[model samples]
Target: MHLGQLAQITIYPVKSSAGLNLTQTQIEPRGLRFDRRWMIVAAATGHFLSARETPQLLQLLVQPSEQGLHLQAPGLDLQVATPAPDGQRQVSVWDDELSARLADSETNNRLSDWLGQAVQLVYMAPENQRAIDPRYATAAAQSVSFADGYPILLLSAASLSELNRRLLEKGRGALSMARFRPNLVVDTALAAHAEDAWKRIQIGAAEFAVVKPCVRCVLTTIDPDTLQREPDNEPLKTLIEYRRSPKGVTFGMNLIPLNQAELALGMSVVRLA
Candidate 1:
């Protein structure tokens, strides 16, 4: 397995929604340019929202426009401007809250009904004030799409296989890679910390440096199909016992591409000393 060859490339234009697969994708400092750049919000409270709290957001399908953004679900299709209005409102992600824009009335109504709730849309704007967590200072205060806080999440296929082996031993059903929601999935011949070696690796025409190990979260416990939090927490517990980091048990490496290059699935990835 090679690092450069993309085993899979998926994007959630709308946070918590289904991912779109692409044979080739652009790599930007803050992850794919249009990635989680836009998010649906709560119209009444002017708060930024996500599938983390309401997993139903996963059902919304987003259609990318040259400028406008459109989302459609069960029976609703809503279209709005790319950069939301100028007026700012306080928006929160987990514990961090920041200034963001609330979508206009028309768009909000459309999305709310589709979601079977009252909600609006919000877009993260370019700003210089944001900063990364102290532990990930190496990532800097770069602008990020709607992705939690990190730019990208990378996972190794072999790592998942190893975990599945353990699951089988415990008589647990096998899990799919989608459960991890990785932007870059590498197939590493090496053992643990295989991604750590990505510090300087070439895949196809692209080169990258591992920025930091991604900390696992409760989101991992949420099953995409059922959209319900798992009870056993077997994988997470197993990871903690085997893959705990100073922050926590980390399964993937968040990476930033060092050089721009055309990348495609099945391309060759080489580790550089």
Candidate 2:
């Protein structure tokens, strides 16, 4: 049965940085190709940095290239070649500790200057296997890139529309879908929050298990456009009023791909369970 059409596909090549919208992409075991394959970490602590603490990261635009990534921020424009795998370094992403390849010192210095803080850009090579949380993963070997937890996050347009409706009723302005930063946005005819009940779904040729409801966080409160935090935490504050759960205030669904396939805009989406 047709539940919706794939309306948007976004990949954050560099975690917490601006995302790139794609018309089509290949789905790999970790996630869409190059998705969150790179990340910025604090120079001293080797801990990951995200828009949650430094909203300025959102202003950094990253574009993948044949050679590596082209990053643009404020007055800086840089083309960083893919770091050699030999430059392995230990980095921490929340509770996951993994090895990542460090970019050259030149690239690191430039980025540090741009952010006004010492930071390093690191790449997650294919060999760096950061396993998903055991309880939610379908397989013991299931791995994720540098994403918060899951490989993919799926949200329905109807869900955002419903949220907007509630925001409007509260005299708050509507928010953009970018605020949620989903990898897949399905335009469905189903009622708001209908996706909360979906256990499995097929998009284009790929099948996915809806492993968990994505817990909302402070990152969602950051305005993608201006790279500023909402004074009153409008949507998140509003979401807390009703979307709260034992897991936390939730919005989108976290997914683990069951197979490799391609996803394209306008592809038919079917709820499998």
Candidate 3:
């Protein structure tokens, strides 16, 4: 709707876990480095597992390491090495079937025991390519990591403010921005849902195409800190009352990088198209 500014940048080194903030970072085609590069999947079925079903994943905190990534949770901590593409594992994310680098049996066992379910932490190999949905992606060949469908999820601060206002009016407590889990958070002043109309935008030196309105899911209903659901599922249920579309009830916008780019916090966001 008007001029906006990038207020924060967050990276989820592991899928569906807590994200770590950064001052600045390179923007790869897939996403920021280590962003959703790793995910926890079912050992038997090899399907992607996330906070949607196992809220325990939300308790893990991510940190980038020289060897690979570091993960810390309530009673466990893991330092995962970057796996070679040699260990092949067929895994599925949504409709995209891609080969992922499987972790060692020990790592799998530890994670499985901690979650109380059989699961393995896998990495996206260089050869692994999960192509973005061509219908929304700016380029047909663009690929992503373990993120739902796009490279980035951008949310506006004004949007959360509006949602909080609605919750307050309804006699419900407010929720935090972490509930939505975005890669980038922009301050749109007072324009709620302004990002919905953005086609393309420049954040500092980085150019991103706003591909699609991100659909809200069951995962959004979980509390990031407690890893528990709100008794009312207030925000999501409230969002559905007005934000539903033919596609789904949506919240933020998904973005795809236009070229090699770098983004930092406090950058001014300029609409390009």
* Best model number under lDDT: 2
lDDT of each: 0.71, 0.92, 0.87
Best by TM-score: 2
> What is the C-alpha lDDT profile of model 3 across 84-129, one tens digit per residue?
7789799999888989999888788889989999999889977898
What stretches of model 1 exceed 4 Å from their correct place?
Answer: 1-4, 44-47, 84-88, 94-98, 125-129, 134-141, 259-261
Error of 3 at 38 (Å): 0.3
The sequence of per-residue lDDT tens digits that candidate 1 reaches over residues 1-273 is 344345877777766777766678777655665677667777676556766688777667776654767777667666777654576677666556677666677887777777778886776666513344556545455545667767677787888998888888888888888888887777657674577656666778777666688888877777888889879885797778788878888888876666556667777767774
Model 3 misplacement above 4 A? none
- lDDT of the structure predicted as candidate 3: 0.87
Q: Give me candidate 2's TM-score against the actual structure.
A: 0.98
Error of 1 at 214 (Å): 1.2
* TM per candidate: 0.84, 0.98, 0.96
TM-score of 1: 0.84
User: lDDT of model 1 at residue 28?
Assistant: 67
How many angstroms is residue 29 displaced in model 2 relative to the true structure, after the best TM-score fit?
0.3
Model 3: how large is the Cα RMSD against the reference? 1.3
